[model samples]
Target: MTPDTTAPTLALLLVDLQNAYFEAPALAGVRESLIERANELVRAARAAGRPVVLVRTEHARDRSTWTINMRADGEGFAFRGTEQAAYVSTLERAGAIDVVKTRDDAFHGTRLREVLSGLGVSQLLIGGVSTHSCVAETAMAAFAHDYRVAIAGEAVASENGSLAAAMLDFLTEELRQPVLDHAASLRLLQGPLDAR
Candidate 1:
C-alpha cells in the first residue's frame, strides 16, 4: 500500500550503521555500495520531511556481556565513544535522532519505540547494515507494533548476500510489506499521501 502523504508521518530507522560494522572484513564486499545506498535513503527521507533515526550498537569495553569477536582479517568491534562507533560523514546528522542500542533489536531496552510513537509515526522506512540481523529484527518489530513498514531494497546488506535476499523476499512476500527502491520511496513520500 502506498503511504498517505497528507497524514503519513514516517520514521526512517537506520539500523546499526556504525564504523565497526562497515569496516568489518566480512562486509568488505558490499561496504561501499551499502553506504552509498544508505546515504540515498537518508537524502530521500530528509527531502520528504520525514523523521530520521540513527541507531548504533554500543558495547562496553570490558566484554562482560555479549562478546563481539571480529574476524582475523576484520577490524574488531569498538565500544561507544570510540571513532569506530561514529556515523559516516557523508550522512547528515542535523534533525536526526541518535539512538544508542546495546542489542540487535532497536526496540529492546531502547527508547526507539516510544520516540516513534510520540512522533505519531504511522509508517517506518528501514535501512542500514546487517540485513539479516539488526535490520530484519527491527523491521519485524515495527510490523508487530502495527506500523506500515517499508524496507529500502538497496539500502540494506548482510555479510551473506543470499541471506539478505531471502530476508528481503520474506518481508515483501510473506509479510506483505513493501520493499521499495530509493527512487520509488522518495516519490511516494514527496507526493500527496492521501490514497489515490
Candidate 2:
C-alpha cells in the first residue's frame, strides 16, 4: 500500500535503546547497523512532525524484579538513572516524550497509554533493541489495544538474528501488523496517517 502524505499524527515508540543493552557483553553479536537504522527512523519521525516516545528500562536500586528470571550473567544490568539506562547518543533527546518503564511492556504501570490517548494518536510506529522481548511485546500490545501498529524490521535487533526474524514474522503474519523496513516506515511517516 502507498503511504499517506496527510501528516498522520504518528507516535514513534523507541523501546530500550539504552546504553546498557548496547554495551552488554552477552549481546555481543548485535550489529551496530541496527542502531544506525533506528536513528534514521527517529530522524524521519521528527521530520514528519510525528510525536516521539522514548521508553527507557529502569530497575530499582534493589534490582529485585529485574534480576528475577534473568540469566546470572545479565543480572542487575538495568539500574535506574545509571548511564546504562540512558538513551543512546545518536538519538535526539529533545522534543520527545520520555517515560520510564520497570517491566518489559512499556504500557504496564506507565503513562504511555494515557499520553497516546491524549495526543489522539491512532497509530504506533515501534522500533528498538531486544526485538524478541520488549520490542515485540510492545508491538503486540499496541495492536491488541486497537491501535494500528507498524514495526521497523531493520530498526530492531536482538542478541540473535533468528529470534528477531521469528518475532517479526509472527507479528506480521499471525498478528497481522505491518512489519516494514526502515525505508518503508519513513515513507509511511511522510504520508498521511490515515492512508492504508
Candidate 3:
C-alpha cells in the first residue's frame, strides 16, 4: 500500500547531513548528489512555507555520551562544538530549526516532535545519510508517532548501494511507505497540504 499523502500540514526532516558523515570514504561517491537533492527539497519547503528541520548527531567530547559499542570502538563521534560535527557547508541552513541528537532516532531526547507539533506538521518528508541506520530509525519512529512519513529516494544515501537498496525495499515494499524522488518530493511538499 502507498502512504496516505493527505495531511493538513507537513515538514521536511533532514537527518545527519553533517561534515563528519559526508567525509567518510564510503559516502564520497554519492555525497555531492545527495546534498544537491537535499538542497532542492529545502528550497521547495521554503517556497511552500513549510518548516525544514536539520537534525545532527553530537555527543560529549569525553565520549561519555557515546553508545557502548561506539565507545568501545574508541572512535570519537560528532562531538559538540567541533568542526567535524558542523553541518556540511553546501546545504542551506538559514531559518531551519536545528536539532542536536545523541542517538540514531531524531525523536529520541530531542525537540523534533515539539517543533513539528508547533508547526502543525502531521506529515514529514525525510532524507539524509546512512540509509540503513539513522534514516531508517527515524522513519520507523515517525510512523509509530502517527505522523505520515515519506522518504525522499534520491536525497538519502548510504555507505553502500546494497544497504541503501535494502532499506528502500523494506520501507517501500514491506512497510508500504512512499519513497519519492527529489522532483516528486518537491511537488508533494510545495503543493497545497489541505487533506483530500
Candidate 4:
C-alpha cells in the first residue's frame, strides 16, 4: 500500500503488552507467541534506531478509569501500582519510551501525540495485546490523526480468538489499516522512508 504521508519519522508502537492481560486465563495459549513476535519487532526497531513506544494501560486502584466489564470482572487488570500493569520483562527495553494510558485509545489522555510529533513521526507500526480492544482502538486513533498506521498481526493477540481475527480483518479491509506480518513490519520499521 502507498504511504499516506511523507513525514520523516516512523515508530513501533507496542500497545498494552503488560503482564495483566498475558496472565489472563483466556489468553494463555497465544501469549508467549505474541510476546516473542513483539520482541522480534522491538529488537529490530531498536537496532535500526527507530523509537519503540510502549503504550500501556494503568488505572486507579478504585477502578475509576475502568469500564463496567472491567470493574465487574475484577481480575485486577492493569491496576495502578500493581505488577499486572507492568510491562513484561522481556518486552521492556532500556531506551524505549513509555506512555501510560487509562483508556483503550492511547492518545486519548496521554502524551503519545506530542511525543510522536516531537520525534517528527508520521507513521506508526502498531502491535501488542487484546487485538479487539486497545490495539484496534489505538490503531483507529492513529489513523484518525492522519498517521500512516500498520499493525503487526503476529505480534498481537486477544482473549477472544474469533473476535481478534475479525478485528484484524476489519482494520485492514474496513479501516484501511494494513495488518502486516512480522517480517513486513520489520522492514517497515527498519527501512528508510521516502525522502520528505
The prediction achieving the highest lDDT against the true structure is 3
For model 2, how does the per-residue alpha-carbon lDDT over 25-123 read when each residue is reduced to its tens digit?
545455467667777777887887888899988887665656456645566767776788787777666788898887778888898988877767778
Task: Give stretches of model 4 more than 4 Å off.
Answer: 1-8, 71-76
Q: Residue 13's C-alpha lDDT in candidate 3?
A: 94
The Cα RMSD of model 2 versus the native structure comes to: 4.7
By lDDT: ranked, best first? 3, 4, 2, 1
lDDT of 1 by residue, 127-177 (tens): 898888899888887888887888877777788778888888888887777
- For candidate 3, write residues 5-88 as lDDT tens digits: 442378899999998897878787778888888998999999888889999999997877788788889887788888879998
The weakest ten consecutive residues by lDDT in model 2 span 1-10
| Candidate 1 lDDT for residue 155 | 79
Q: What are the C-alpha RMSDs, in order, of all predicted structures?
A: 4.7, 4.7, 4.3, 4.0
Pairs that collide in candidate 1 are 4-193, 5-193
For residue 99, model 1's alpha carbon misses the true position, in angstroms, by: 0.9
- TM values, all candidates: 0.83, 0.86, 0.91, 0.89
Sort all candidates by TM-score, best to worst.
3, 4, 2, 1
Task: Write the number of the candidate with greater TM-score, choosing between 1 and 4.
Answer: 4
- What overall lDDT, based on C-alpha atoms, would model 4 receive against the true structure? 0.83
